[model samples]
Target: MPPSGGSPVEPPSGSEGGVMLSDVMGRDRSINLFAGFLRDIETAFRRLEDSSQNTTVLAPLNSAVEKLPRKPWEDPQDYGALGPNAYEGGEGRERAQQNLRKFVEAHMVPLSPWAEGEKVRPIGGDRELWWEERDGAKLIQPDAIEVVGIAGEVANGQVWIIKGVCHLT
Candidate 1:
């Protein structure tokens, strides 16, 4: 006769009490991608600041620190033609600008990682995301990169986690 207990379950392949590739690639990309996205936002902010003078208040986002090797604006790949919802001409261009603004607003939000204390939450999604603590300091589990630590608040300004590198996403 079969055993009275419930059937045994098999653990996932290549992940036996160890970190999975998904863990390494997934969440890490989110940070990197967001950093890239921030470049455009910063540029837009700079433009606004120039026009508004000192009257406009602009708090710099953490993503501002990221030095993007290449910018999408510089690319002549013709993203407009690539997608079905391409923006062409004056009205289309305006729509595209507005769309970008909305994206920034939704993703670049104020986050207080220090104030909350331990377990930093990701801004991109509802899922709970946090950094593991080690010896009273937060250990940055930056996928395969092995980021030892980072000073200042990791919270704030559109934090997200995605599978694989920014290019893949």
Candidate 2:
């Protein structure tokens, strides 16, 4: 949380800051990996851009992303069913895109200046997320992902650097 009891109002463009999400995240070094991940997923990138200033981006740092068990576009469920050819052809491409989309969506909350206690279902996601302060840290629920800091504030919303990835499925 930026400030305790900060104004929870939603801006018309979903941001009071006069900036774009792409420019903010794309240029920030700490958020580079997450930004590139979104760029690879066309619709997911657009969704975040379209959501600008109005959403919350819980970006994982380079270290956290690099530590993932597999690539963001790779989902175990799909792999189990489709096997090694899961990402081989046109169908594979679509599945990869879908997995990428899910990954990106899980990192975003539909509103900006969100409160700590309110439960929120991320954009294009079914799971609910919420956070609370403990030991001077804002930790998001389920995985207790830590909110490291604010990466950038764009015209659409603020990009929060988080320590862990939330579960998607």
Candidate No. with top lDDT: 2
Against the true structure, candidate 2 has what lDDT?
Answer: 0.75
Note the residue pairs that clash in candidate 1: 111-156
Error in Å for residue 77 of model 2: 2.0
Candidate 2 residue lDDT tens string, 111-140: 888898999998867889999999999998
lDDT on C-alpha atoms for all candidate structures: 0.31, 0.75
What local lDDT does model 2 show for residue 141?
Answer: 88
Q: lDDT tens digits, residues 13-122, model 1? A: 44333432222211343254333333345433332223122111112223432443433222224454545334555544554544444333333222332332243323
TM-scores of the candidates in the order shown: 0.29, 0.83
